[model samples]
Target: MHLNRRHFLGTGIAASALLTAPTVWGQAKPKVVVIGGGAGGATAARYLAKDSGGAIEVTLVEANPVYTTCFFSNLYLGGFRDFESLQHNYDKLAGGGVTVINDMATGVDRAAKTVTLAGGQVLPYDRLVLSPGIDFKDGSVPGWSLDAAEKMPHAYKAGPQTQLLKKMVEEMPEGGVFAMIAPPNPYRCPPGPYERISMIAHVLKQKNPTAKIIVADPKEKFSKQALFEEGWNKHYAGMVEWIGPDFGGGKVEVRPDAMEVVIDGEVTKVDCCNVIPGQMAGKIAALAGVTDDSGWAPVDPATMKAKADENVWVLGDSSAQGDMPKSGFSANSQAKVAAMTIRGELTGSKTFPAKYSNTCWSLIAPDDGVKVGASYEPTPEKIASVESFISETGEDAALRKATYEESLGWYAGITADMFG
Candidate 1:
């Protein structure tokens, strides 16, 4: 079945309603330290506190007091949503019994089961959950690094980068070129780069109709390729060009200072550049010694337990789980399973089999949305997709509008699920 808004919301709420655990007595509560405050960590931390009912002490360690969701951030570029709408706070999580710490976790002494924060606090955890999301691989993009982001933003992480990219787009010279260097495979949000292209095209179409968009993608094909291509042609005709590796799209370098792009040794001056480089699990996971050489933490398909350590669980964009895309929905689904397993292990609560589902919605134009999703089950090798669905090319406008409406409901429901 499709993992629509209603189904997603129902499953999440049902998971929380499973059972109230017996409170602990005459003993210190088992502590769970959750790193990162995105969909995965936030939901995991909240669920552990809510269902365990004082049996498990859940502490969430996030650098930022308020989280700006990477999901739907492209819509902000398209002017479909305001920047403030993307930001969420930990006030509700704290009210829900989660110890929300606003500090950076700089070190993890896994052998001692302690996380050292930059503020000089060492938090002990019976279980450590890492959902720290993606960090760019240094030197992944030649001539571009974190320092260059000020000139050519990689709005992949949202917040200031998102705002900067939007500003650059809005301030572009008339009929100017907007170039994007897309990431390689296995990146967070498979269709993200393309959706962002569509949203940027939407903005350019309205503000600077003659502006051009060029995408330098390493991959030959992408998720929802047909759907996005159809939307681009129908809505932003003659305004977009896609250069794949077949055309030297992979051989790319940027001069952020000069605002120039080198594609296949051919130089092109661009008004704005968005460089999305290769990515890996956030640094904290590697510091915890759970991530493999691939720079991603591998987890058991059944429980999201880190393959390198029994006490560590990896979720969201950081985990090298199979089949499921690194999406907010996927992270949220994995968190529920991890929360349930942790509760059962720590407090003797009833545990259920892990069933994961995810849906990724991309807005191509106003009221024009497309999605790809699947339901997943764990096998010996990996978490495999059991069923899948996608919005087809040439879908009716009303259906696309309904799909967009569904995404709005999902955003409201998911943020509530994460924060409250």
Candidate 2:
């Protein structure tokens, strides 16, 4: 069956609906410390508190008061969503009796199982859940680093970078070149840069119809390539160009100061450049000693618990689970399993068998959306895909529109799931 948000979330398939524990007033509640406020952490934190009914003391340590989801950020550029709509607060989670802290977690002492914050407070955890999102690999892109972000924004993390990239695209001179250096594989949002290109094209197609987009991608093929290419051709013909590694797309560099893109040693001046370098798990996961040499935390596929420490669980973009893409939906799915397992271990709560699912939706144009998804069962080896589905290339307009509408509902439902 094609699982929509209603069936996926409402049916308790995404998370266990009955996560109850016998609450005791005289007892010390088990404490769960969740780091990062993205899909994984937020969902885990919310579910831990909401279901535990005061049996688990959930303290969420997030650096930001408002979370700007990277999922729907592309729509903001396409004029489909406003900036404020992408931002969500912890009000619902707080109302559910969760202690939400806004502070950076600087270090983790694994032996002590304590997280040290930037503000000098050390938090102890019976269970530590780290769902910190992706962080760029230093020097992954030639001549591009975090310092050069202002000149050539990656916009990968959302928030100010998203707004900056939008402003840069809007302010570009007519017919100017909008260049993008796509990240390599194993990056966040497999089809993100492409969808971003489409959204940017959507904006430029209307405001700066003469603007040109050049994509230098390391991979020859991308997720939903046919769908995106078809839409680009049908909607924004002659306005977009994609260069793959076969065409020296991989041997590319950016000169942020000069606002230029060097493709295969050939220099081209660009009005705006979006440089997305290779990525790895966020810094906190590495600090916690949960991540492997690959910079992603390896976890037991069955429980989403890090192999390094059973007391710790990793979720979202930081986890090296198999098959599932590093998407918000996947993270949210994984968070539920992790949360339930932790609750069972800590509070002796009712536990359910682990089931996971994910779907990634990309909008190629206004009301034109495509998606790929799968349901999973965890083996000792990996979280393997048992069933899968994708939008067909020749799908009708009504289907595409419906897919887009489904994505919107998913956004609404998922945000409610995470923060509430």
Task: Estimate every model's Cα lDDT from 0 to 1.
Answer: 0.93, 0.91
Q: List TM-scores for all candidates, in order.
A: 0.94, 0.93
Distance from true location, Cα of 262 in model 1, Å: 0.6
TM-score (C-alpha) between model 2 and the true structure: 0.93
**Across residues 1-420, which tens digit of lDDT does each residue of candidate 1 receive?**
223533664565565456453232323468899999999999999999999987788999999988999999999999999999999999999999999999999999888788889997878789999999999999988999999999999999989999999999999999999999999978999989999999999999999999999999889999999999999999999999999999999999999999899999999999999999999999999988898999999999999999998999999999998999999999999999999999999988999999999999999999999989999999998999999999999889999999999999999999999999
Worst lDDT run of 10 residues, candidate 1, spans: 19-28
Highest lDDT: which candidate?
Answer: 1
- On the 0 to 100 scale, the lDDT of residue 292 in model 2 is 92
Candidate 1 stretches greater than 4 Å from native: 1-27
- Return the TM-score for candidate 1, rounded to 2 decimals: 0.94
Worst 10 residues of 2 by lDDT: 19-28
RMSD (Å) per prediction: 8.9, 8.9
Question: Which stretches of candidate 2 lie above 4 Å from their native place?
Answer: 1-27
Clashes of each: 0, 0
